[model samples]
Target: QPVTEEPSALAPPAAKPKSAVFYRHLRLDFPAIVRGEGSYLILDDGRRILDASGGAAVACIGHSDARVGEAIMSQIKSASYCATLLYTSTVCEQLCRLLVDSTNGQMARAYIVCSGSEAMEASLKLARQYFLEKTQPEPQRTHFIARHQSYHGNTLGALAVGGHKSRRLPYEPILSTNVSHVSPCYAYRGKKAGESDAEYVVRLADELDAEFQRVGPEKVCAFVAEPVVGGALGAVPSVPGYFKAIQAVCRKYGALFICDEVMCGMGRTGSLHAWQQEEGVFPDIQTYGKCLGGGYQPIAGILASHEIIDTISKGSGAFVTGHTYQGHPVSCAAALAVQHIVAEENLLANVSELGPYLGELLTKRLGDHPYVGDIRGRGFFWGIELVEDKATARPFPPKANVAMEIIDLGLKGADYSVALYPGSGTADGVSGDHVILAPMFNASRAEIETIAD
Candidate 1:
């Protein structure tokens, strides 16, 4: 009998090895990054792509910082992992203390986590727990009120509270029904033709109030919002008095105020906390990530106000949630180092000083572009909104993928070698396009100019 060859032996080799990693976009091929040098990402093909958006506004100090690497190594040599429930590491304590101090003691406690989504999930649970732990417990307070076009996180609880239409579409069936959304404080479109800022804010506040009443104010646990809307609305900041009015509504309804500053916090907006710029808008519970660890390690956290902490302290003395890596020592060490660098170098001041010039450069360059409908942002975080018709402020249809196309082109170095963050559904929940530019906190004037150019 003739020897039979196995089918595998007869087959030819594949053109490329199959990737074990699951990519966000399955069909698209991604560039392999070799290393990061300052603000540029060196690709395997030898191209240098400027990290203009800081990889979704996370790399505050840019990449490849020797200080962060040293801190990580030091932490690993000492203590790499610790069961947060059983023991707390010094680095974790120091990082938490630094966070609380940054808020001038307004935020009384910090709960560390691995990502913004985890931090947001904790915030939701803690808010609900706060009501349960109150002197006169309001167990009925199970509802949450969030703004339309806002994004908190992708977890089930976070997704329920977030009002981004596209993101919630697939998960709507499983999302909790206890959350409802009102219009966002998007003055660009929400503001009527001749409406003043104060009037727009009042209208928004009234809408929020009506939603609370509809949901039954006593049943609402908290009202969640981003200080300056990121991702979903493309860095849209509330008009003056917007947060004050909305927060007043939350107070009136006896609901806690939760500010999700994952993208806009950690000096990204030229302030230690985004709420610092919004007068009289202190949050009862705030979630922060992105720049927290400066992309040096996976870390995010929730800063709870004294009232919430006191109630929980008096009631159970424990937050009823835990993650296997909640207070990972290595992550905390990296974040601590990143935060110290920001403070030592006065990066927040740099953001403030160069922020206006960056804005000016963006406006001057793209303000007259036919597709450029709006240019708005604060500090190093800015967005350029693209439109189909400038006069009508009409967005290109979602299928067009205008923002993604521009970003892809930039990454491919067709026109410019820069990476930008893209946002869709700006006009409604499915039609507009905008690109975000969140440069590193330590970005120099020349770097900002290159980004804008």
Candidate 2:
């Protein structure tokens, strides 16, 4: 007689090999993405996932573009590395020129870096240094004012300036004390029941002004904000005249207005810079990344206004900060190629034409759903906020992990295959949830339909 086998249920699960890589979620196993084609990612298991969020709105042109790859290789063959202090490459100059030209002289200088965090860090340092270099130096100007529910980056300096509550919780003890927070221009939650757009703008602007006064206006260096907030608040755009009002407050205090376009700039909002869409709201120091390199290379930078650059040039004759990988040749080449493609292909036109359609589709599809609290965004970037109670706009508790759950299901569910960017703490920086849908700038109408569907 054959030996009787133990029941399958009685047998222990096979021991899997432990992964060597430290993941963001230690207990979860991530799917391996083998390659990308157009708007989809090909996983190792052979499933094609529609890249709806472009990997945090970075892949504006989509993945694996031959042109960008060629540019990167060409730059590598010529020169990949250089000491930024001792030398600067032609590619770096070209990239900087392209950025400054895009700003149409509003931004006079560009300082390249490896990520948005570095750009923001540089922006903060440059703001401080600018004050020190002024003809009448205000050494007392050590404070920075930023909006609540804002996310700049992960570096300590960036984190200190950021107001995302959950992201800052763990590092609160170490974050700088020089930064203070103000209310973000979130109409869905922040606006009063009977308030008009103009009224809301005034109220928020007054709050910012009061904060500056509270902090002692003369001691403030800058008022930092994202024209269209990204992860922290799920692609929330300020109402009309919001930026102008706030900029006035900054101007009144003689504080620089630093716009962080890390997730919403570079044609992601149908403008080279998000502030360009806001009338008379030019930033003194602007930080941009994400779509800057179109995910082909790791690159980011800050565009400084003429005043700040002139101040530094006259006083220090040099920026006080520097990074080892600043102005890396290959990264600059990749970014330059990406920006050129964006311009040559007229992808901004695509974004401008299709962005409203995408929004309309999302509203038609999910607007009535009890869970969809709000839908807001511009250009290729849009967000669907989820709520537990539509009547009250009540957010699910943090333990529910609603946003991540939806994202995980989208990735692994049998009915659909899509990748979305998730955000938490949307309601009060701890309980609200939202999912962003940021298709590539070159995404087709058909792809937009698929994403909305």
Candidate 3:
């Protein structure tokens, strides 16, 4: 029942997709989402679809959150926007305070913005300024190390550092040449046949070290990576001791470790930050988005540790970057409210409790399916890899479009609507394929069961 753009003989009965206005199919034909309640999105025609992917895993508290709405409305009633440069609003200050408290003061500052890409950009600029202010201004220290098959953002700078070859291909001629990529710690694909977990972690750490050394240790500013691989590689978690080892290497070379938790952080992985869940590992700089504002008003920001901020404050008095919409009041207040409700209701507790059961249910429902190759994730984030053969883990050719097929069936025939967050080249940035599913944090067990089944 999966609809393909290709011509096929055995297609199911359905309305033809209507013409889109903005872009092509890969560009648009997405339904006009009319309204949402709980985990369900009502389309313009009134078809209720389960929001399994939570609109790119952004709506953590789900739609119809009265508290978040009320908080935003209250802020709007007074003032909707306030430029952080001249006037500092109480909402922005309180939000920063909350974020700092969440990290137990290890985080010294938060730079808020209107989108995830903006947050990532601010993080990079902030890191650059931090070193300059400290008088360690090594202009050559502009290089960064990232992993393959990972997605950070769409802006040229962030996209340049990202590993998704397909997304970066068109912009290669113009992308910054300061980035070098190493292998991601995708155990299912990157692990050797006879190697132990410790060995694999060491290998990846060693790769990072070599990259830093190749780029010149003094020139490498930071190593950026997602704590748990999202987007491009599905919901892959690194091997045990992976982040610790990587952190050690980065520290040995005096490079900052920037964790891009735009997808996996903010209670999506049972902990407020995914890096917090890792043993003896925390990032020097961190970026969060998506659930930070629960997809309410488009908000995100960078959190810097006290060490980084002190170095900057003592060195330079002002950040070099400028954005008119940075630290907009309504977005910050909405995010604060979402964070508050998440705490007051103890929704993270549910994410932890329901996550394991959902995993089990997924395995129970699809374990025996011939095409399912790998099922992996943590907390509410999950991914299913489909292959031509499960034993060999050989993915279907792009021409076959296995993920699209399964997703189409899951959406239409299954009487459920879900966003198909799949990745091509999940194995090596070119070949492996997978579908990611991240349900809302406040989702009911029964609703989760229905969605899973």
Candidate 4:
């Protein structure tokens, strides 16, 4: 029997929304974003704020791209949702093929997901599953090794693997106990005096080796890291041969190497893959997002090496995970269009050409500023660390919220009309302030200068 209730004639009027749509910050009054243009966000109040950080470096191709919208609409007109468990879509196949081809066959398979966090979570699961599927069958290999002061994602699985103290503080008691963290190869703060780059690489490699030994190498599944430290470390890149050294250690310990390029991959670092720019560094599994879909439809994915995929295919005959929207057709269509634009416009060249120029300009403009401590990055990604004492590289206390204040000043200050990425807890995982500048990959010289000024 079905019961239907008619609306009461005397029903009280519905209460107001109470300002619906929960925001990231409950106390702060956020702006209403009505529209976005080329490298700019339009507010409901008619303010046009320049987007200098690409909204956490997500808008690689900028916003209001009609081509992407059209592609999305085309797919939506066809069909929006398909149960992927029993079927597949052309757009999804095309996107996967394009991703594999982009890797030049280095990565043999692609698992399309909805966000970077999903991609990373998949990577972690795949790595552990791979060990189980191998002929050796390492059921005991359950632990993961990551770096301290790094951020993977917010989900429980990703959060467990991440080492950001502030973000993990609330969930520390509930996070997975199988993950351990090692020191990040940060030259600015981690390197000892008088140590050469080669020596530093060796030293870090030794640290990884020691960690594996301490954790019982047979119990470890993989070592995960971000090729270029993103917001957690304020765009810090490792020295030459750093990754090669770390990868070697992982190989020596029978552990897989996983690189989290969610915030730094897919041409954000000038190269299509950050690992491609490195001389001899590569990953068994890699995660990418943000720029992968250019914030169009919230898409991300993981690329796996042939060896890893073959093991699973031969053993379980299928992956042990499923998501209703794992390969959404509309999202794939939008990402495909965004990727096509990235290629058709040859934006990578633009990124390569302008990256150094942007760095040079930032150095020239803010290098001598008293509060500026260190400026380091590569390609279109750059960061400016603010300090209390430049000579000592002393960061402002966490309570000061220097980075957030700079972001606010840039957005509302009469002098500088721009939006920058604010980063905190960059020093010792508790007290540090820095701002990141990740302009659009297709930014013109004038726009770059504007960001610098």
What C-alpha RMSD separates each model from the true structure? 7.2, 5.9, 4.9, 7.7
User: Which parts of model 3 are misplaced by more than 4 Å?
Assistant: 1-28, 135-138, 418-420, 426-431
Q: Which structure among the candidates has the greatest lDDT?
A: 2
TM-score versus the correct structure, for each prediction: 0.95, 0.95, 0.92, 0.94
| Residue 308 C-alpha lDDT in model 2 | 93
CA deviation > 4 Å runs, candidate 2: 1-17, 135-138, 426-431
The lDDT per prediction is 0.88, 0.89, 0.82, 0.87
Task: Please write out the lDDT profile of model 2 over residues 285-345, one tens digit for every residue.
Answer: 9999989998888999999999999988988799989989999999999999999999999
**lDDT value, residue 434 of candidate 2:** 92
Write one digit per residue (lDDT tens) for candidate 1, span 1-453.
111224343343344356667777887766667678788787655567889999899998989999899999999999989997789999999999999998977899999999999999999999989888783633789999998878999898899999887789998999999999998888777899999999999899999999987888889999999988889878888899999999899999899999999999999999999999999778999999999999999999999999999989988999999999998999999999999999999999999999989999999999999999899999989988889999998889887899999999887755458999999864353336899999998888988888887
lDDT of 4 by residue, 261-322 (tens): 99999998899899888788879999999998999988998999999989888888898887
Candidate 4's C-alpha runs over 4 A off are 1-18, 135-138, 426-431
- Of models 1 and 3, which has the larger TM-score? 1
Deviation of model 2 at 444, angstroms: 0.8
Give the Å shift of residue 361 in candidate 4.
Answer: 0.8
Q: Write the per-residue lDDT of candidate 3 for residues 9-95, one digit (tens) a residue.
A: 324236746565655366546656656777777665445667788867788888878888899899999988897679989999999
Model 4 — which ten-residue stretch has the worst lDDT?
A: 1-10
365 in model 1: Cα distance from truth in Å? 0.5
